[model samples]
Target: MREHYRDFLIRNWEKGDRTRAAAVISYVLSEYGLGWEPNDADRDVLQVEEFYLATGGEFWVIEHQSQIVGTGAYYPINRGEKAVEIRKMYLLPSVRGIGLGKYLLQQLEAAIANRGFQQIWIETASILVEAVKLYESHGYQPETGVETARCDRVYVKYLD
Candidate 1:
């Protein structure tokens, strides 16, 4: 991979990041010929902190040249549950093949493990071949019985 984004910064999601996050999400889905669904609307991007941080979870954004290029988050599946659900991980085409996705996944995994979670679940579309490969490469295994109607693939990783 070439060194294209030397100034890339990965940080926790904060106030006022919703607009950029939403744009990145929209762009990625549209690029893949997908549209916003009910699940997307339910997320309420503007209240990320409330939906993630306030619920013993976290959301992060990757910024390059002061623009948000990627977004990822994990939220508790349920109160008192030892597992969390990974959601909304998206990256722009310009930064896709440079290890940023792996970096983001690693960071999110570390954060989730640090919080004492044992299992991490992720739901994604079957058409997102790169993402599936990324997760499998990092030790995420495919699992059955996913709950989301919007996504067709489910994966789980158990932290050591």
Candidate 2:
């Protein structure tokens, strides 16, 4: 499938978007056996909301004809870090393999770069081969750091 690119407005997520965001998070979490069983908790949803309100992070929804097909976010790291973590990337199953994920990542990286961030980092499960490939293809490489036993891999890219 071919994906047509368009500028998705990045904005502060509203409470009403919580349900849709939860669905996206749930689908992703379950797809990778993240131990987040359905109806178990709204932890992902609450985290997203907190990320927005606490760190002033930004989220972008990949809207096709006014429907949210995917979502992603960028959040700050620390004082004078000039870096951010790409988090909660998820796309509908129908949109997978359509180049939409790549386009969304590109836009997200560009958006962060435009904000003057110099580095970007992302963590993915070992089971998520597709996501790992996407990050590697986009120049993200495995990094040595505080290893997350729960996460199989961690990647970083310097946007110099």
Candidate 3:
């Protein structure tokens, strides 16, 4: 971790970022005792092109000191009309609580709105208390029908 959390850079994924980005996601999930399996819970991570970039969506990589430390992304989903689902929003333990998560989330929201998506949906596990609070604090209202195997909660927010 660097002293300047704000010094990191967020950019569209490159073909070479696949492994490092997936590792970042896996490390963060493991910190909470969660499991990640390629082509399953992490299928989109494995196929970033097919699941995201090729489908009118995006996946971003956050890097600090030349190392990838976090990831955030979204993709259009069938959950709601003109809606997109936020996925793979993970920050390493060392980078938590420095406002980076909030910044990254805002970036995601802006992209969604810029694309004319009417709303944003998020599915997460209750054990990830920080993420739960982040979404709730940002006005993502609680909802039903969490489709992820490890998630027990859902939140959705309509764009203005």
Clashes of each: 0, 0, 0
Q: Sort by lDDT, best first: what order?
A: 3, 1, 2
lDDT of 1 by residue, 54-96 (tens): 8888888888998999988888885225989988899999998
User: Which residue pairs show collisions in model 1?
Assistant: none
Superposition error at 93 for model 3 (Å): 0.8
Worst 10 residues of 2 by lDDT: 1-10
Quick one: ranking by TM-score, best first? 3, 1, 2
- Give TM-scores for every candidate, taking all chains together and pairing residue i with residue i: 0.89, 0.80, 0.95
Predictions in order: lDDT: 0.81, 0.71, 0.91
Better structure of 1 and 2 per lDDT: 1
lDDT string, candidate 3, 41-142, tens digits: 799998999999999999998999889999999999998789999999999988888999999998899889999999899999999999999999999999
Q: What is the lDDT of residue 46 in candidate 2?
A: 55
Of the two candidates 2 and 3, the one with more favorable lDDT, higher being better, is 3
